[model samples]
Target: MTHAIPNVLTIAGSDSGGGAGIQADLKAFSALGAYGASVITALTAQNTRGVTAIHTPDPGFVTAQLDAVFDDIRIDAVKIGMLANAQIARAVADALRRYQPKHIVLDTVMISKSNHALLAPDAVAAVRDELLPLASLVTPNLPEAAALLGEAAVTDEAGMIRQGEALRALGAQAVLMKGGHLAASDSPDWLIQEHGTLRLGGPRVPVKNTHGTGCTLSSSIAALVAQRDDLASAVAEAKVYLTGALQASDQLEVGSGVGPVHHFYRWW
Candidate 1:
């Protein structure tokens, strides 16, 4: 008997650095054994150091891109990132309402590691209101979680659990609250879905190239979901894969400032 490779779609921005956004998502999908496709919502003039400028395609073009992919291929899952503006966010939300992919992992990508704003300041409400509701899972770091909730940043495991519940109340069926920002002993994340909550914890890899950790983790979950794994199982597998990639990041140097995680760590 023959089998088909899972097809995962990433609708996000372009990172000239090749370390985050659409690039990282594609790399994660391929490294994890899934077929990947993309619709670029915005383009950024950026590198490992920081982002300088960003340009979002006309929102109409974004819709066309989504249609082009959906009309042609059957996407098993979708991963959304750096929408750039309310228009782009609404476009993504509208597409999700239309195509209704089996699984959607929305990484509420707002601020870049270099302290640049990926999404416009005014677009925050659109993301919290429009897009959050459609996602099968919403992956937000501490700051993003706080922004979505209009509260102070969640700083501990208990805070994460509370915010995870709050995020679900905002509309996401599942919430993965990433604890990478906490100055804690380990990297802990909370996954709250219809099922019971799971606390995912791992030793923090002491590496500098964690620029795309959030994108990588969210895309990894989307890829696993596309491959027919359950939501909780997908989250668990993605965490393991991201940690390994972080641990192996020291093995490669793509740029001078900060580097990217070794998305293909299994190869080396």
Candidate 2:
């Protein structure tokens, strides 16, 4: 019998539309040739339109799921997103401390694609205090970076670099400040920190299917890191993958609103 591939685990919320959150993370891992596992933190009544309701799973249950996966599976990397409350945040942090996985990619998912808040105000502090420090890399879009640092805006590349360095000080070994939602420019996303900074700009591809871009990007980075890619290389590859996915997204219509990027863009 053939042996199974190494696994990557995602601890995140469930997106009913299958566009983002755990769904997108798992898909990205699979498309990138890694086995995927998940411990769901919350369930959102979400679709392409927006999130109508959110139900956080019991923290104990969340913990149990993590224990089950870590105790048996060989999780080479872990991607974290959308822990809706302080308890869930603490629960996830506790699991990470116990497992000490090789890589922890934190996608600070503060708001949904439709502009709905996915995280609570108090939970932001929990994420900053408990979670960010534990991350190998934290991938935050402009708004999330601003929220994490209590800044009003991260309006430009220089601001992103400053916020990225500040996030590094908060405990992340590195930071990938996404430039997608930043002021429009010809630049690719910027990855910055005290160690170094790399501008990952590619030709901007116009597409409406971007609901899962952040989840897919972070998970792709985790997958590459699991396979021994250095921080800069992994991020670069992830950017290429995301751009292709976005460019190919013109053909897919997963929902009425913003659809999902094609995780298997390379395949088809």
Candidate 3:
């Protein structure tokens, strides 16, 4: 007898380095025992060093991909990443309006791990207006949160909670402010809700192979949600999975620069 698996969709860019973007999301989904689907919005000439260039796919083609996926598949959750431009962001927003999947995890991928700008400067408002409200949870790193709020000092846990609260006020039901970029002794991320905030803390691993940690975490949350976990439980489980992935990444050498996490570490 065949068993049915939960399906999760990732709308993101293609990372040539295979460390992030759609590649990472698909890996995380499969690692979490979910069926993964994708709608690529941009292609990047990137490696561990940096993104040399980016080419945004046509908005019409992006919509076409979404239509194809939603027209046939029963997508349980969606993990959105790397909408490189306003047009792509608008298209994705339209698709979200059309499909309206049960759980939407938005990874506000403003900048890549290699220090390249993934989202345009002018598109921040578009993302906030079109996507953030539609997302069940918005996961943004320190820099992305700063960019979103136009504030330069959201670098601590208190600032993160404030920023998360501001983002939730802007319309996100929940916010997960990632602290991996912060230079703290204990890297503590805050999950802010209407009720209160829960701090998730863990020691920072001294590993350079953390290129796709954000994408992986958000995708893992989406996968867990697809499996019917509640929002808080899904986020908690994804954090655990990401911590393990980071700890187990020491064994692999994918690239000379920042490398990919070991998504299948448990199996191997």
Over the stretch 1-268, how does candidate 2's per-residue lDDT look in tens digits? 0334668999999999998999999999998878899999999999988999999989999999999999999888899999999999999999999999988999999899888999999999999999999999999988888889998777888888888899899988889888877657554577776668888887667777888988999999988778754778888888889888998997786878888998887887
Query: How does residue 233 of candidate 1 score in lDDT?
Result: 81
Off by over 4 Å in 2: 1-4
Candidates ranked by TM-score: 1, 3, 2
lDDT at 234, model 2? 85
Candidate 3 residue 240 C-alpha distance from true site, Å: 1.0
Consecutive 10-residue window with the lowest summed lDDT within model 2: 1-10
Q: What is the C-alpha local distance difference test score of each model?
A: 0.91, 0.88, 0.90
- By lDDT, the better pick of 1 and 2 is 1
Candidate 1 stretches with Cα past 4 Å from truth are: 1-3
RMSD (Cα, Å) for all candidates, in order, is 1.4, 2.1, 1.9
- Predictions ranked by lDDT, top down? 1, 3, 2
Residue-wise C-alpha lDDT for candidate 1, range 137-236, written one tens digit per residue: 9999999999989999977889999989999998898999998899987888889887678998888888888878889999999998877568888899
Model 3 residue runs over 4 Å out of place are: 1-3
- Which candidate's TM-score is highest? 1
- Backbone collision count in every prediction? 0, 1, 0
Better of 2 and 3 by lDDT: 3
> Which of 1 and 2 is ahead in TM-score?
1
